[model samples]
Target: MAGGGRGGTGWSSLPADLLLAIFALLSSDADRVRFRAVCAAWATAAAAWCPRPWLVGSRTDRSGRGGGTVSSFWLFRPAGAGAALLRPFAATVPEGLDYLSSSRGYLALADPSVSPKAVVLVNPVTGRRVRLPPIGFFKRWLDVTTVVLSADPGGAAEWAAVAVGFPTTSLAYYSSAAGAWARLDFAAPGYAGVEHYSGRFYVAFGSRICALEADGDAPAVIPLERVDDDGADGSDDEPKLPGGSGRRVVETHLVECDGQLLLVSVHDDVVYSSDDDMGGLAVDEGGSKGGGDARAVEVHRVEWLWDGLVRLVRETDLGRNALFLGRNRAFALSAAEFPACRVNCVYLVDRQGHPDGVVRVLDLENPWACREETICPDDATGGSASSAGWARRGWFFPNY
Candidate 1:
């Protein structure tokens, strides 16, 4: 009561440093947001405290609740040898809105019920919404892989939202500062992913990271120096799994961890549901690897040379942070800050292979080697159940 309650004479009068000290101990992001809402002084002191991310797309079984308007979001924490804690993070999102991309604590969801399809940014926890202007050139909103926000919606300043897809190299963005949705085209397309790092937005191609300068008007792309079959342990080189699993595809993501940006490459091995000559990728009721799982994963440190280019330095281990990658925009969390998170590890949802929504928990220290863990919604039976669409919408840092 001495530091954070009411008027000038009451708890709000305490030193700003003391309020921040208490904020550090609260742990959860929602608790910190509540603390900030105490008063203007408390909110000012908490401006610098960044909370760990909570995965975005978790839903309770429709067996109860009659398929209401809001769908709950959850965070999966490692509980024991083979268990998880599916804690409710954002519990009030609209029912039918499919999660397309997430940024600034809001999910860019596609409304499929409509004829042409609409994209709306929804703050899952608060039920706030921002309707973006439709790009006439681009009608396919669901195909967008990731959405990046310049700042949180409804804030004092103007903000922007950028949507990117690996398969579709076209950049479709909406800037509040500019007042309309614009699509930026590229002459040569080789981008595998895109992410915001430091102060600039970057696109990934092979082992290259390029900054997209002057986005809305007169944009220019600059790629970093590429490494070829180099490094002490072939880290920069795109990794390949031991020859057994048929038809493998590796996806790369740029993640900011412990003050530096990291390039993470994941190899998803394809599996078929039956022994019959299947025409396409299908999974029935199986394919969960336990006992030192050998899913190939690689992490590389991005060393910015500053003069319009950067280089990739191979990282053998992540000290205390775990990188979350899958369907959602990639984010990193420290185990020291969030105890439930496993240090030197990765929680990856298989978007390419698994149909039953089985998440692979890989140990970063030894990418091929991993411990057994079972992650699923608390309401569901296990990972064997059909939840492909829900599982693909991964985690996000819900700011509020």
Candidate 2:
């Protein structure tokens, strides 16, 4: 037997369930992979630990594990649950390649090492990987607006779906099971961004919010206007916004908060944008019919409260500013407004006062903080914020 090896008692000696329980407690993806390498028994333990897509009522806890992990994960440890980046699995991709987007626990990476224009989809937790289909001609031209990983709303196992938006106003999808890429049936190549939440996936383009219905053969596309019709499309020649003023030109971001789809944008300090047009406005002649990117869009004044609980606790005109939400509320911060020409502190405006109490201010400057707001922009525009409860441990892995 090898020195220091447990010759007498192997991993099999452990009660199968007990081994599973222990593995479940170690949330770090790197740790999980390391445990598998110890011996065949450990590997078996990991294989037997296939997680069901949904763990009902099982909250994501991420409090301990010291600083961070090698990759990012929404994981649970005995201490707590939160989002963190686990160490990257040993894989080949070029260096300086950064993470682009993530959804359904999968990430899209842009590494210059492999191909100059390709994005790699990988599950940091299991080190499962899939190379995105070649963007072909589009790769040679338009910049990729967004590349997000999502699960089929219909409940497919171990199969992740990829949604990519192009500046050419096109949207493409790639599925793990299909092993191929195809364009979504929707028209208006103006598709800009995507997000997944509450058993559904959403894409925001021009002024439309479309939902993905994976329950059928092919994912069904439903316009979100049925629920909330008031969305802004910036392509209109003479855009109309609330308050009789022209709509503030700004970008949109999608976030899953408290089981509801949330829209956030930063237009101006203290005066985030708001969409009072309950009727749901539309851009007139914005489509190709319009000469320019005439997409007529509405902006909403947003005040992020605590987590996803509160909406519009404050108000402002949103435009080039960056917005972020946590728990029930949201915050709007703009680099252009700050004298330092950068965000230094991101104060959480709870009902009573700032969560940090003004003394030990939340360091918005922390790379982690910036990423909190920026990495997963509701619109995938890229910015940063503080580490959420679940994002602490895996902060080491860059989520882009």
| TM-score for all models, in order of appearance | 0.73, 0.44
Worst 10 residues of 1 by lDDT: 277-286
Q: What does candidate 2's lDDT look like per residue over 1-400, in tens digits?
A: 1243366765456766787788878755577777777767667776766441101000111332211112222212223433211112232222354444444444455543345466666665555666766655355322354555555222466454545543434455666666655556555543244666555566654344566666544666665432222443233322234555544434444554333454533211112145353222223221121122222323332233343222221122233332332211122334453221123332211111111111011232232222221112111112311222221111112111
Instruction: List where candidate 1 sits over 4 angstroms from the true fold.
Output: 1-35, 41-52, 58-73, 76-83, 88-90, 186-191, 227-249, 270-294, 352-355, 367-369, 379-391
Which residue runs does candidate 2 get wrong by more than 4 Å? 1-29, 32-96, 113-116, 137-142, 152-160, 166-168, 185-191, 213-222, 227-249, 268-400
Cα lDDT tens digits for candidate 1, 308-364:
445667676788987787754687888787776787777776542233444566665
lDDT of 2 at 196: 61
